[model samples]
Target: MDMMMVIYNGLLSDEYIKGQATGRIKFYEYPPTGDISGPYIVIDPLGPPQSADYGDNIPIKDDYLYQIDVWTKNRLVTKELSKRVQKVMRSIGFGYFAGGVDEYDKDTGIYRDARRYRGKAYTEEFEI
Candidate 1:
Protein backbone atom coordinates (compact mmCIF):
# COMPACT_ATOMS: atom_id res chain seq x y z
CA MET A 1 0.00 0.00 0.00
CA ASP A 2 1.12 3.55 -0.60
CA MET A 3 2.34 5.53 2.37
CA MET A 4 -0.07 8.32 1.53
CA MET A 5 -2.92 5.83 1.46
CA VAL A 6 -1.90 4.67 4.90
CA ILE A 7 -1.88 8.22 6.12
CA TYR A 8 -5.30 8.78 4.58
CA ASN A 9 -6.80 5.71 6.25
CA GLY A 10 -5.20 6.67 9.55
CA LEU A 11 -7.01 10.02 9.08
CA LEU A 12 -3.71 11.89 9.56
CA SER A 13 -3.23 13.06 5.99
CA ASP A 14 -4.36 16.57 5.11
CA GLU A 15 -5.34 15.38 1.63
CA TYR A 16 -7.88 13.01 3.09
CA ILE A 17 -11.60 13.83 3.24
CA LYS A 18 -12.73 13.37 6.81
CA GLY A 19 -15.73 11.08 7.32
CA GLN A 20 -16.23 10.60 3.61
CA ALA A 21 -16.63 6.86 3.82
CA THR A 22 -19.16 6.65 6.62
CA GLY A 23 -21.89 9.09 5.57
CA ARG A 24 -24.20 9.52 8.55
CA ILE A 25 -26.17 12.73 8.95
CA LYS A 26 -28.26 13.95 11.83
CA PHE A 27 -32.03 13.77 11.13
CA TYR A 28 -35.45 13.40 12.74
CA GLU A 29 -39.03 12.39 12.02
CA TYR A 30 -42.15 14.25 13.07
CA PRO A 31 -45.90 13.75 12.62
CA PRO A 32 -46.75 10.10 13.05
CA THR A 33 -43.01 9.40 13.14
CA GLY A 34 -43.71 6.40 10.93
CA ASP A 35 -40.14 6.09 9.65
CA ILE A 36 -37.77 7.30 6.96
CA SER A 37 -34.30 6.27 5.93
CA GLY A 38 -31.52 7.27 3.59
CA PRO A 39 -28.46 5.81 1.90
CA TYR A 40 -25.59 4.33 3.94
CA ILE A 41 -22.50 2.12 3.60
CA VAL A 42 -21.64 -1.39 4.67
CA ILE A 43 -18.15 -2.70 5.38
CA ASP A 44 -17.36 -6.34 4.81
CA PRO A 45 -15.46 -8.35 7.38
CA LEU A 46 -11.91 -8.68 6.22
CA GLY A 47 -8.36 -8.32 7.39
CA PRO A 48 -6.66 -4.98 7.14
CA PRO A 49 -5.29 -3.84 3.82
CA GLN A 50 -1.83 -5.13 2.89
CA SER A 51 0.75 -2.60 4.02
CA ALA A 52 4.52 -2.28 4.53
CA ASP A 53 6.49 0.50 6.17
CA TYR A 54 8.07 2.82 3.64
CA GLY A 55 10.55 4.79 5.71
CA ASP A 56 10.83 8.60 5.82
CA ASN A 57 11.66 9.06 2.15
CA ILE A 58 8.06 9.03 0.92
CA PRO A 59 6.68 10.56 -2.25
CA ILE A 60 3.33 12.24 -3.04
CA LYS A 61 2.01 12.75 -6.51
CA ASP A 62 -0.92 14.34 -8.30
CA ASP A 63 -1.24 11.18 -10.40
CA TYR A 64 -1.99 9.39 -7.12
CA LEU A 65 -5.68 9.06 -8.07
CA TYR A 66 -6.08 5.68 -6.43
CA GLN A 67 -6.80 7.39 -3.14
CA ILE A 68 -10.00 8.87 -4.51
CA ASP A 69 -10.96 5.58 -6.12
CA VAL A 70 -10.36 3.69 -2.89
CA TRP A 71 -12.35 6.28 -1.00
CA THR A 72 -15.26 5.79 -3.38
CA LYS A 73 -15.15 2.04 -2.96
CA ASN A 74 -15.08 2.42 0.80
CA ARG A 75 -17.99 4.81 0.66
CA LEU A 76 -20.06 2.35 -1.28
CA VAL A 77 -19.30 -0.37 1.21
CA THR A 78 -20.19 1.96 4.06
CA LYS A 79 -23.49 2.73 2.42
CA GLU A 80 -24.23 -0.94 2.47
CA LEU A 81 -23.31 -1.12 6.14
CA SER A 82 -25.89 1.53 6.89
CA LYS A 83 -28.66 -0.91 5.97
CA ARG A 84 -28.59 -2.37 9.45
CA VAL A 85 -29.00 1.02 10.99
CA GLN A 86 -31.84 1.93 8.65
CA LYS A 87 -33.64 -1.28 9.49
CA VAL A 88 -33.34 -0.63 13.21
CA MET A 89 -34.50 2.95 12.88
CA ARG A 90 -37.47 1.96 10.75
CA SER A 91 -38.45 -0.61 13.29
CA ILE A 92 -38.57 2.08 15.95
CA GLY A 93 -40.55 4.48 13.73
CA PHE A 94 -37.74 6.98 13.52
CA GLY A 95 -35.92 8.65 10.67
CA TYR A 96 -32.37 8.25 9.33
CA PHE A 97 -30.34 10.49 7.07
CA ALA A 98 -26.68 10.99 6.22
CA GLY A 99 -24.48 13.59 4.60
CA GLY A 100 -21.39 15.73 4.98
CA VAL A 101 -21.26 18.87 7.04
CA ASP A 102 -19.30 21.98 6.15
CA GLU A 103 -19.55 23.44 9.66
CA TYR A 104 -21.14 23.00 13.08
CA ASP A 105 -21.86 25.00 16.24
CA LYS A 106 -21.72 22.25 18.85
CA ASP A 107 -21.92 24.51 21.91
CA THR A 108 -25.37 25.90 21.18
CA GLY A 109 -26.67 23.60 18.47
CA ILE A 110 -30.32 23.16 17.48
CA TYR A 111 -30.20 19.70 15.94
CA ARG A 112 -33.75 18.75 14.85
CA ASP A 113 -36.89 20.72 14.18
CA ALA A 114 -40.13 19.90 12.41
CA ARG A 115 -40.67 22.35 9.59
CA ARG A 116 -44.42 21.91 9.92
CA TYR A 117 -44.44 22.35 13.72
CA ARG A 118 -43.66 26.08 13.70
CA GLY A 119 -40.45 25.42 15.68
CA LYS A 120 -42.43 25.13 18.85
CA ALA A 121 -41.01 21.72 19.81
CA TYR A 122 -37.31 21.26 19.03
CA THR A 123 -35.63 17.95 19.73
CA GLU A 124 -31.96 17.16 19.85
CA GLU A 125 -31.07 13.67 18.77
CA PHE A 126 -27.58 12.82 19.98
CA GLU A 127 -25.41 10.62 17.81
CA ILE A 128 -25.20 7.16 19.24
Candidate 2:
Protein backbone atom coordinates (compact mmCIF):
# COMPACT_ATOMS: atom_id res chain seq x y z
CA MET A 1 0.00 0.00 0.00
CA ASP A 2 1.03 3.56 -0.62
CA MET A 3 2.53 5.26 2.41
CA MET A 4 0.06 8.09 2.49
CA MET A 5 -2.82 5.71 2.07
CA VAL A 6 -1.56 3.65 4.94
CA ILE A 7 -1.31 6.66 7.19
CA TYR A 8 -4.70 7.96 6.08
CA ASN A 9 -6.33 4.62 6.75
CA GLY A 10 -4.70 4.41 10.13
CA LEU A 11 -5.97 7.85 11.06
CA LEU A 12 -9.43 7.00 9.81
CA SER A 13 -9.47 3.85 11.87
CA ASP A 14 -8.43 5.70 15.02
CA GLU A 15 -11.39 6.07 17.34
CA TYR A 16 -10.42 9.47 18.71
CA ILE A 17 -9.67 10.98 15.34
CA LYS A 18 -12.67 9.39 13.70
CA GLY A 19 -15.00 10.58 16.42
CA GLN A 20 -13.66 14.12 16.39
CA ALA A 21 -13.12 14.65 12.68
CA THR A 22 -14.90 12.00 10.76
CA GLY A 23 -14.31 12.26 7.02
CA ARG A 24 -12.37 15.44 7.62
CA ILE A 25 -8.84 14.20 7.07
CA LYS A 26 -7.76 15.04 3.57
CA PHE A 27 -4.80 13.97 1.47
CA TYR A 28 -2.58 16.42 -0.41
CA GLU A 29 -5.09 19.26 -0.23
CA TYR A 30 -8.57 20.13 0.85
CA PRO A 31 -11.55 20.35 -1.49
CA PRO A 32 -11.93 23.49 -3.56
CA THR A 33 -15.53 24.11 -2.64
CA GLY A 34 -17.00 22.50 0.41
CA ASP A 35 -17.70 22.91 4.07
CA ILE A 36 -14.07 23.49 4.99
CA SER A 37 -14.53 24.08 8.67
CA GLY A 38 -11.80 24.44 11.23
CA PRO A 39 -10.18 21.56 13.11
CA TYR A 40 -9.42 19.61 9.94
CA ILE A 41 -6.16 17.96 8.95
CA VAL A 42 -4.19 17.96 5.72
CA ILE A 43 -1.60 15.36 4.86
CA ASP A 44 1.23 16.35 2.55
CA PRO A 45 4.34 14.61 1.36
CA LEU A 46 7.57 16.21 2.39
CA GLY A 47 9.47 14.62 -0.48
CA PRO A 48 10.24 11.33 -2.16
CA PRO A 49 11.09 8.38 -0.01
CA GLN A 50 14.74 7.48 0.36
CA SER A 51 16.40 4.13 0.75
CA ALA A 52 17.14 3.50 4.37
CA ASP A 53 19.68 0.85 3.54
CA TYR A 54 20.75 -1.38 0.68
CA GLY A 55 22.06 -4.92 0.31
CA ASP A 56 23.43 -6.52 -2.83
CA ASN A 57 22.36 -3.45 -4.81
CA ILE A 58 18.81 -3.74 -3.54
CA PRO A 59 16.91 -1.54 -1.19
CA ILE A 60 16.04 -3.46 1.94
CA LYS A 61 14.04 -0.72 3.56
CA ASP A 62 12.59 2.65 2.61
CA ASP A 63 12.01 5.69 4.74
CA TYR A 64 9.15 8.05 4.04
CA LEU A 65 8.76 11.58 5.39
CA TYR A 66 5.42 13.26 5.71
CA GLN A 67 3.86 16.28 7.35
CA ILE A 68 0.46 16.31 9.03
CA ASP A 69 -0.96 19.76 9.48
CA VAL A 70 -3.73 20.48 11.97
CA TRP A 71 -5.61 23.65 11.31
CA THR A 72 -8.11 25.35 13.54
CA LYS A 73 -9.43 28.78 14.35
CA ASN A 74 -9.08 28.31 18.07
CA ARG A 75 -5.67 27.96 19.69
CA LEU A 76 -6.79 25.32 22.16
CA VAL A 77 -8.49 23.28 19.47
CA THR A 78 -5.39 23.47 17.35
CA LYS A 79 -3.25 22.06 20.14
CA GLU A 80 -5.70 19.29 20.87
CA LEU A 81 -5.97 18.28 17.24
CA SER A 82 -2.20 18.25 16.86
CA LYS A 83 -1.86 15.98 19.86
CA ARG A 84 -4.43 13.60 18.44
CA VAL A 85 -2.56 13.45 15.15
CA GLN A 86 0.70 12.75 16.97
CA LYS A 87 -0.81 9.90 18.91
CA VAL A 88 -2.28 8.35 15.78
CA MET A 89 1.02 8.58 13.91
CA ARG A 90 2.98 7.11 16.78
CA SER A 91 0.57 4.23 17.01
CA ILE A 92 1.29 3.56 13.34
CA GLY A 93 5.01 3.17 14.12
CA PHE A 94 6.22 6.52 12.90
CA GLY A 95 9.22 8.24 14.48
CA TYR A 96 8.28 11.65 15.69
CA PHE A 97 10.41 14.72 15.00
CA ALA A 98 10.37 18.32 16.04
CA GLY A 99 7.77 20.24 14.09
CA GLY A 100 7.26 23.95 13.76
CA VAL A 101 4.26 26.20 14.19
CA ASP A 102 2.97 28.74 11.75
CA GLU A 103 1.89 32.28 12.43
CA TYR A 104 -1.78 32.96 12.72
CA ASP A 105 -3.38 33.83 9.41
CA LYS A 106 -5.08 37.12 9.74
CA ASP A 107 -7.14 36.74 6.61
CA THR A 108 -8.47 33.26 7.27
CA GLY A 109 -8.12 33.29 11.05
CA ILE A 110 -6.58 29.85 10.81
CA TYR A 111 -3.78 28.58 12.98
CA ARG A 112 -1.72 25.69 11.62
CA ASP A 113 0.49 23.34 13.58
CA ALA A 114 2.53 20.88 11.55
CA ARG A 115 4.14 17.67 12.68
CA ARG A 116 6.73 15.61 10.85
CA TYR A 117 7.11 11.85 11.05
CA ARG A 118 9.30 9.20 9.49
CA GLY A 119 7.98 5.74 8.76
CA LYS A 120 9.99 2.77 7.67
CA ALA A 121 8.69 -0.11 5.63
CA TYR A 122 10.31 -3.04 3.93
CA THR A 123 10.54 -3.44 0.14
CA GLU A 124 11.49 -6.30 -2.08
CA GLU A 125 12.54 -6.61 -5.71
CA PHE A 126 14.49 -9.09 -7.76
CA GLU A 127 16.78 -8.43 -10.66
CA ILE A 128 15.93 -10.17 -13.90
Candidate 3:
Protein backbone atom coordinates (compact mmCIF):
# COMPACT_ATOMS: atom_id res chain seq x y z
CA MET A 1 0.00 0.00 0.00
CA ASP A 2 2.72 2.43 0.92
CA MET A 3 4.70 1.49 -2.15
CA MET A 4 1.80 2.57 -4.34
CA MET A 5 2.31 6.12 -3.18
CA VAL A 6 5.97 5.87 -4.09
CA ILE A 7 5.04 4.56 -7.51
CA TYR A 8 2.55 7.39 -8.08
CA ASN A 9 4.99 9.97 -6.81
CA GLY A 10 7.59 8.64 -9.20
CA LEU A 11 5.29 8.34 -12.22
CA LEU A 12 3.65 11.81 -12.01
CA SER A 13 6.87 13.57 -12.97
CA ASP A 14 5.91 14.19 -16.58
CA GLU A 15 6.37 17.58 -18.15
CA TYR A 16 2.69 18.45 -18.29
CA ILE A 17 2.10 17.72 -14.63
CA LYS A 18 5.29 19.47 -13.65
CA GLY A 19 4.63 22.57 -15.73
CA GLN A 20 1.00 23.08 -14.69
CA ALA A 21 1.42 22.62 -10.95
CA THR A 22 2.83 25.74 -9.35
CA GLY A 23 3.22 24.05 -5.96
CA ARG A 24 4.70 20.79 -4.72
CA ILE A 25 3.28 17.36 -5.49
CA LYS A 26 2.93 15.86 -2.08
CA PHE A 27 2.36 12.20 -1.16
CA TYR A 28 -0.28 12.87 1.47
CA GLU A 29 -3.84 14.13 0.94
CA TYR A 30 -3.58 17.14 3.23
CA PRO A 31 -2.11 20.38 1.99
CA PRO A 32 1.07 21.60 3.57
CA THR A 33 1.11 24.23 6.28
CA GLY A 34 1.59 27.92 5.39
CA ASP A 35 0.95 29.62 2.08
CA ILE A 36 2.89 27.75 -0.55
CA SER A 37 0.45 28.93 -3.18
CA GLY A 38 -0.36 28.25 -6.81
CA PRO A 39 -1.45 24.98 -8.46
CA TYR A 40 -0.51 21.79 -6.60
CA ILE A 41 -1.15 18.05 -6.56
CA VAL A 42 -1.75 15.60 -3.71
CA ILE A 43 -1.61 11.81 -3.92
CA ASP A 44 -3.07 9.51 -1.28
CA PRO A 45 -4.17 5.90 -0.98
CA LEU A 46 -7.78 5.30 -0.03
CA GLY A 47 -6.96 2.26 2.13
CA PRO A 48 -5.07 -0.99 2.19
CA PRO A 49 -4.67 -2.86 -1.06
CA GLN A 50 -7.07 -5.75 -1.61
CA SER A 51 -5.62 -9.16 -2.24
CA ALA A 52 -6.44 -10.69 -5.59
CA ASP A 53 -5.50 -13.86 -7.45
CA TYR A 54 -4.18 -16.85 -5.58
CA GLY A 55 -1.27 -19.15 -6.23
CA ASP A 56 -1.11 -22.16 -3.93
CA ASN A 57 -3.26 -20.17 -1.49
CA ILE A 58 -0.83 -17.30 -1.60
CA PRO A 59 -1.83 -13.93 -2.97
CA ILE A 60 -0.44 -13.15 -6.37
CA LYS A 61 -1.76 -9.63 -6.95
CA ASP A 62 -3.29 -6.75 -5.10
CA ASP A 63 -5.86 -4.14 -6.16
CA TYR A 64 -5.20 -0.57 -5.20
CA LEU A 65 -7.48 2.45 -4.88
CA TYR A 66 -5.89 5.85 -4.91
CA GLN A 67 -6.99 9.44 -5.08
CA ILE A 68 -5.21 12.15 -7.00
CA ASP A 69 -6.18 15.71 -6.18
CA VAL A 70 -5.47 18.78 -8.26
CA TRP A 71 -5.76 22.13 -6.53
CA THR A 72 -5.39 25.54 -8.09
CA LYS A 73 -6.82 29.03 -8.23
CA ASN A 74 -7.73 28.72 -11.92
CA ARG A 75 -10.46 26.43 -13.17
CA LEU A 76 -8.80 25.89 -16.52
CA VAL A 77 -5.54 24.86 -14.94
CA THR A 78 -7.35 22.52 -12.60
CA LYS A 79 -9.21 20.83 -15.45
CA GLU A 80 -6.19 20.61 -17.72
CA LEU A 81 -3.98 19.34 -14.93
CA SER A 82 -6.58 16.77 -14.02
CA LYS A 83 -6.51 15.37 -17.54
CA ARG A 84 -2.75 15.42 -17.63
CA VAL A 85 -2.77 13.51 -14.38
CA GLN A 86 -5.17 10.98 -15.83
CA LYS A 87 -2.82 10.52 -18.73
CA VAL A 88 0.05 9.93 -16.39
CA MET A 89 -2.03 7.59 -14.31
CA ARG A 90 -2.95 5.55 -17.39
CA SER A 91 0.64 5.45 -18.47
CA ILE A 92 1.42 3.78 -15.16
CA GLY A 93 -1.34 1.17 -15.64
CA PHE A 94 -4.03 2.90 -13.60
CA GLY A 95 -6.65 2.03 -16.23
CA TYR A 96 -9.57 2.35 -13.87
CA PHE A 97 -10.36 6.06 -13.91
CA ALA A 98 -13.15 6.43 -11.40
CA GLY A 99 -13.64 10.09 -12.41
CA GLY A 100 -13.54 13.26 -10.30
CA VAL A 101 -15.68 15.80 -8.52
CA ASP A 102 -15.34 19.53 -8.11
CA GLU A 103 -14.57 20.94 -4.69
CA TYR A 104 -13.90 24.45 -3.47
CA ASP A 105 -12.38 25.88 -0.34
CA LYS A 106 -14.36 29.00 0.48
CA ASP A 107 -11.76 30.33 2.85
CA THR A 108 -8.87 29.87 0.43
CA GLY A 109 -10.86 30.25 -2.78
CA ILE A 110 -8.99 27.31 -4.24
CA TYR A 111 -10.51 24.87 -6.69
CA ARG A 112 -9.92 21.16 -6.38
CA ASP A 113 -10.69 18.24 -8.67
CA ALA A 114 -10.45 14.99 -6.78
CA ARG A 115 -9.99 11.97 -9.02
CA ARG A 116 -9.88 8.27 -8.18
CA TYR A 117 -8.07 5.43 -9.93
CA ARG A 118 -7.75 1.68 -9.46
CA GLY A 119 -4.86 -0.48 -10.52
CA LYS A 120 -3.25 -3.75 -9.68
CA ALA A 121 0.15 -4.57 -8.38
CA TYR A 122 2.65 -6.74 -10.32
CA THR A 123 1.41 -4.96 -13.43
CA GLU A 124 3.57 -3.01 -15.85
CA GLU A 125 3.78 0.02 -13.59
CA PHE A 126 3.76 -1.62 -10.18
CA GLU A 127 6.86 -3.74 -10.26
CA ILE A 128 7.00 -4.34 -6.57
- TM-score, per-candidate, Cα-based: 0.20, 0.81, 0.78
Model 1 scores a TM of 0.20
Q: What is the C-alpha lDDT of each candidate?
A: 0.25, 0.77, 0.73
Off by over 4 Å in 1: 1-73, 97-128
Q: lDDT per residue, candidate 1, 3-61, as tens digits?
A: 23232333322112234433322122121221223321222212223222232543221
Q: Is candidate 1 or candidate 2 better by lDDT?
A: 2
Q: How do the residues 18-124 of candidate 3 rate in per-residue lDDT, one tens digit apiece? A: 66653467777567533537777888888888887666777777888888888887788889988888888787767656566788777777888998988877533
Model 2 per-residue lDDT tens digits across residues 5-89: 8888888876767776777788888533333474688888889989877788878777888999877778887787778788888
lDDT of 3: 0.73
Worst 10 residues of 1 by lDDT: 114-123
Predictions ranked by lDDT, top down? 2, 3, 1
Please tell me which predicted candidate would have the highest TM-score against the true structure: 2
Residue 72, candidate 1: how far off, in angstroms? 10
